[model samples]
Target: MSPGDEHDSFGGVGGSGQTRTRLPEGNSGDVYGGARRPVRSSRSLLAVVGVVVLLVAAIAFANRGGGDPADAAGTSPRKGAPAGDPTAATGVRPVKAKTGTIPTGYAHDEQGAQSAASNYAVALGSDGMFTAGPREDIVRATHDPAVADDLVKRLDASYSADFLTSIGLDENGTAPSGLTFVSRTVPVGAKVLDYTETSATVEVWCTGLLGLAGAGSTKPVTSAWFTLTEKLTWTGGDWRITSSSQTEGPTPVNGDNRASMADEIAAAVEGYGGFTYAR
Candidate 1:
């Protein structure tokens, strides 16, 4: 693993000429494009922020938020596990930055927290998010090294051997011949909940695609919704993930467009690779 375990693998904002949301129309929702899903409500949006703040507070409360003296003295939590790689600021940058419209490297406050949460969502939903190599890089980049292994292990299991094969890949995460895997999160908007110098919580509501696109492919692109609750800690002068979780929808309706041919879809997936999203 790059720096963490597989379990941690489980892990966006935007605006444009087009918009997407999770709420229904009668419910006064918003709509995001590409996938053509329903939008999130203002109250739901607030929930996103609330969830993030509570995450930090809960974790901080659990760890006593680390004494200022210990952190200030640079003797806080030890960076790694006894049997695993020592958790230290790797001093490496995240693989890439982006989530629909939100920028990476957000300001180190509530906004930054939201940015981290949003981008973390993208990282979680990204195609690379499923593979072990990129997955570990993202975990280490986004999280406190102390928790990286736990998260990685959890992710590894989440994407088990059977799961990968079912999704058209071998044990190594490679998609079957002629198939292009598509799992990406596009952010709609973001909000901040709470933040401190070393810790922050943020929520990112996102629309994602999870499936394979290819000729003769049975699994076509599909949409999903879930809020990513990310707990972030500052490391090496940048925000990284400490811990995170995912839950089901807030999903929206499917679009009216006729499904494209599997070959066309596959070609698109292969020809147009994903972006390293930036605000």
Candidate 2:
């Protein structure tokens, strides 16, 4: 109900089951018989609130079993690679440059794999991918060239106008005027489960923010926990992502914090930029 009280809605992308039918472009009154409808009664409002709380709890519980998926038995590659001692000279700095503001130059060894996985998570969760130019840079920097090419086409198709409108954002992922949309990935920890000279796999556990800030907003910024599993390979002397996947969180309960106003929330996002998370 308030700005900072977004703990319940922050990470959710859609209402459980709400649909809206469109009216013809210039059809005044055709949409709803040109009549205003009565607001929900107090009892109905109470029931809705109760159901929302229950749904949030259910979602939190459901996201806990986050290891590998059921179908990953044979399809997923084997976990962590055989132990091989790696020293700093070559392995330590495979990918360590800035492709602009974004991190690039991922190594082609174990450490490289870990760095690639973590940074890739950041790129995947970023606001940049909502727009065209930065989105392409992200894909090219994080993924293998071949994969990047294919993904760019698919990503362009995926972030279409309809998709943007459905999620309360414009085609570029910007919220409406006076609104601030938030999306980011913060890496909490990472581990290299398996690795070889040319390819490696790493898992990163991350927390993220996904929501919109604005007055009278029904959706507020929320938190989510998701693990990113990345399959990477050595190419052009650095680790490049070949593929990756994400599953919902091992999410925790919300802390008791007073909610802020929508304007305040939007201002905070505008004033603060994200960090290059580590460890």
Candidate 3:
């Protein structure tokens, strides 16, 4: 698969296919060694062999229990096989500073660029994007100054009143009194496509929620997956977006879980605040 085509398997979400083991038939002695003993049936012989195998396995495990199991394969269980792989967190603390709830003051490294890209994806795809003031704030805070003004103007034009109304929002970008409009993007992971001290290109795989949540709401909330590519520059001691683009997903198959009720979804969104992701 191409680099952009990579997707998360949503590990253990789907049912596993059952596997059947074919046990050997006939006398055990025929396979193991000499003639069969006079008294024991083949079934009994097989049972004894099973027990012996179990005992041997148990002894081996006991011997191996003294050291880290992952060490046997020369890998860190916490970080996966390749230490530098981007999917694994580097254990570095994330930026503590923020400019209007969006993270800022990244480390001026590839990891920092990646963190900026992921957090920017969250801000750009958030419910805040529906409104003018917050959307402008987000773009200004995350984007490089050279393109920030132009981006804000274009985004303002794009999120028009008609567009908002079609998605079950008012001209002011608010939902009806009893309803909640939800839009949230959560980065599954990030990878650096290209990197240097001054510039980096990063891709964030994201899943999002969009639509209206309430009884009788026409646009019931649903999930979507997409990938965002951010071209970043390390400027003034922090990484900032020069430009970004999004494409439909490299999404995995959907899980079998039942969709939550509108009330449940709204409540969850209200209760959960987003995170400041770091690589």
Candidate 4:
């Protein structure tokens, strides 16, 4: 696969009106024809023209830069609106239970669906997915009963002994001695495409780090962007994935920053803890 293609694939984933002028009873006839139309004075004409010109100018101004004027004014367009704060903590409490680091028992709502999707993306893109035990736990924890078994089987086949080696993992999906195999995904955001009482579809935009972090590692860690769409069901009082599919990128251009050393990357990963994402 091409470098760009390395992390791309997933097997299962108003108008205004002008004013009118009044004319004298018989003067309605035009000078050159049978009917005399009302004549407008230069000042009146200029006033009307000026209003039209101002209207056009205002429209052009609003269209300029294709962004909200409020944004240019250093404020959000949604400033006073009743919307969820992206920077604020979601006041809704987190799930109390977890299945081996994967959050469970999400509330049965759109927010719950989004939370479930974001966490599932992290689980599916984790280093655990490379191993059998954790992979089974992840799949079972996040998927609905109707499809969990099938998904586990598919994932087991996908992450085979040979597949692990291709991605710098051993036959048992372990990194070489002293090396840290990194496969992590952070959800940029999530949106519910469709929602119903029992079912919901959520799309999660994610940025991921993948590959090995250690000396002499051939596949150095790299970043990739992808969107994962999950079809979830409100089963057993929480949202669970019925199916999921992945597609590459809404990726941004790489910045001109210097690449960190392997040790730095490994240290950073070890030092930082991940978040429990919410809508």
- Alpha-carbon local distance difference test for all models: 0.46, 0.51, 0.56, 0.56
Per-candidate TM-scores read: 0.60, 0.65, 0.69, 0.69
Identify the runs in model 3 with alpha carbons over 4 angstroms from their true place: 1-91
RMSD of 3: 22.3
What value does the lDDT take at residue 86 in candidate 1? 21
Error of 2 at 17 (Å): 39
> Where does model 2 exceed 4 Å of error?
1-95
**Candidates ranked, most accurate by lDDT first:** 4, 3, 2, 1
Tens-place lDDT per residue, model 1, 1-279, is 122211111111111222212211111122222332222211221122111111221111112211222111112223551221222222333223433332345555554465466656655555564577766666555566676776667566555576466556778878787777666566554444557788776655555555566767665554445555566777766677765555434444444455566677556555543333222
Can you write out model 4's per-residue Cα lDDT over 1-279, one digit (the tens) per residue?
Answer: 000111221111100111111111111111112121111111111111101001111112112223222221111224453332243345676465677677788877877787788777776666677678977887788777776666566556656686577667788889999888776776776778889999898877666666678888766665545567777888888888776655545544444356778888778666666666655
lDDT string for model 2 (1-279, tens) is 101110111121111121211111111111111121211111211112111111122223222233323222222323664442332233243445766555667555566577667666766666666677877787687677756666676666655676566556777767788777776666656778778898787877666655567896645554445566677878887777776645444443333355566677677667655554322
C-alpha root-mean-square deviation, each candidate: 15.8, 16.9, 22.3, 24.9
Candidate 3 positional error at 161, Å: 1.0
How many backbone clashes does every candidate have?
41, 15, 0, 8
Better of 1 and 2 by TM-score: 2
lDDT of 1: 0.46
